[model samples]
Target: MWSGELLDLDAYLARIGYDGPVGEDGELRPDLGTLYAVHRAHTGAIAFENLDVLLGRPVELGVKALEDKLVHGRRGGYCYEQNSLLAAALERIGFEVSGRGARNRTRGDTLLAVTHAVLVVTVDGEPWLCDAGFGHQGPREPVPLARPGAEVVQGEWTYAVREEEEGILALSILREGIWRDLYAFSPQRYHPVDYVLLNHYSSTHPRSVFVARVIVQHPGDSVHHPVRRALVGRELNRLHADGRVERRSVEPDELLALLDREFGLRLSGRDAEELVRINRAGD
Candidate 1:
């Protein structure tokens, strides 16, 4: 259902630097190990950003569109683009992948619309929560859906799936000794068309944060003690493994360099100029 056939699977595998998970038959395996390897590789190699929204461009969700922009273009994306690309790769490899719409929980107790997109991959009779979006504070690997409240540690970060009200499950992270909710989703499966509508709001609506400011995130650089980085508007926040946050103002002149040097996001000359104009306008 993710339109995997349209994706350049070889390019995606190489883009993420995932070398081998192929079985003895010289075919990609659809096992839990491959799932973990691909998930980690994708999250590490790619970044999470809303640059298109900030650039007044539409956020496309089709597999080929995703491949052209995210994989081939070497650009980072937010929820829909990130997860949909992931779903396609896994589905192409013969994994049973499904989509889900989730609500943002990090923005305090306020209830928000269901705009975020995630994927559920079923492997060997077990389902796992797989997301490459949600920015720096997000998980790098799949968290077990079968084991509620059990923490799955990825590098220096730890994550768990907690059962919320009704049939919904909330993904929580242990930060500063507290289980902070990242985002929550119900069992209601989502389709690409569903995300098209959500993307409309997130990309164009005046109330959407993505349309209002710049957002770029990556899990971290190191495997053992990764430092999660997030750039929101003019402020750059770096969250250390031990729960320390070091934030600084990003000047317009230094914005592009920060994105490339720290987040691995490099835009073309024209796009870079436009981004700088947008950055200056935001201030």
Candidate 2:
């Protein structure tokens, strides 16, 4: 049904080391479950970061661009880049996946516009939210699109759903049970160009975190590693095994090593040097 040649699911899965599937009920099974598997595989596999921005590269949405960046480059991506690649992977695996746009509530009024490129997948005739691009603080499992108050806790963060007007859904997380809006999304169909617009805003806007700072996220077996950089300096925080907080400052050169060693994002030595320079300047 797709116009382009379909992606190879096995190869894609193998590239990311995903082996999960869906069950007979059409829900995501342990081996090949669609939404659950996407979450499990994504958090377990791809990291969330803005290295492209730090490296002064453009983030594109075309399929080849995604494959080249994700599979070939072996790097992590933010929402549009990661989710777009994921949609292709889901489509290849025989799941009905569609692209959707969202507004980042965290940025509030500062951001020039909303962000695009999340996925909605159907499993057992039900829709589930599967996003792997929201960094370390995204949903750990596929959440039901229609279920309000549904929650999933990953490490210290807990994701919950709330319904809003106009058929929109707000995804929130309890940072100590206080609801924080992650983003508001609708199950609307979006063209790749729609994502291009949002991508441009995120990458170019003055107030955007993408342009203003460096963001990194890598997930472990039971913890999440997140770091942020701004004029105030860089902050490195870890979501520990027992859900404790740990914060520290890492050297700029060390940041590159952390990305590769801890987060599994490999960069060339030149890229690493550039990242260190940019991060140092931001400090």
lDDT of each: 0.90, 0.69
Taking all chains together, the TM-score of candidate 1 against the true structure is: 0.97
**1-283 per-residue lDDT for model 2 (tens digits):** 2212455555566667765664677433422245565667766677778888767888877777777777777777888888877777666656777778887787665542457467787777777788878765676667777677777665555678798889888898776547788888875777666778888888877767787567877655332433221111377776543445577777776776776676777777688788778888884
Task: State which candidate has the highest TM-score.
Answer: 1
lDDT value, residue 218 of candidate 2:
60
lDDT (10s digit) by residue, model 1, range 124-152: 99989999988888888888999898988
lDDT at position 194, candidate 2: 75
The true-structure Cα RMSD of candidate 2 reads 4.1
> Candidate 1, which ten residues in sequence have the lowest lDDT sum?
219-228
TM-score of each: 0.97, 0.83
List candidate 2 segments past 4 Å from native: 1-6, 22-32, 107-112, 153-157, 222-233, 240-244
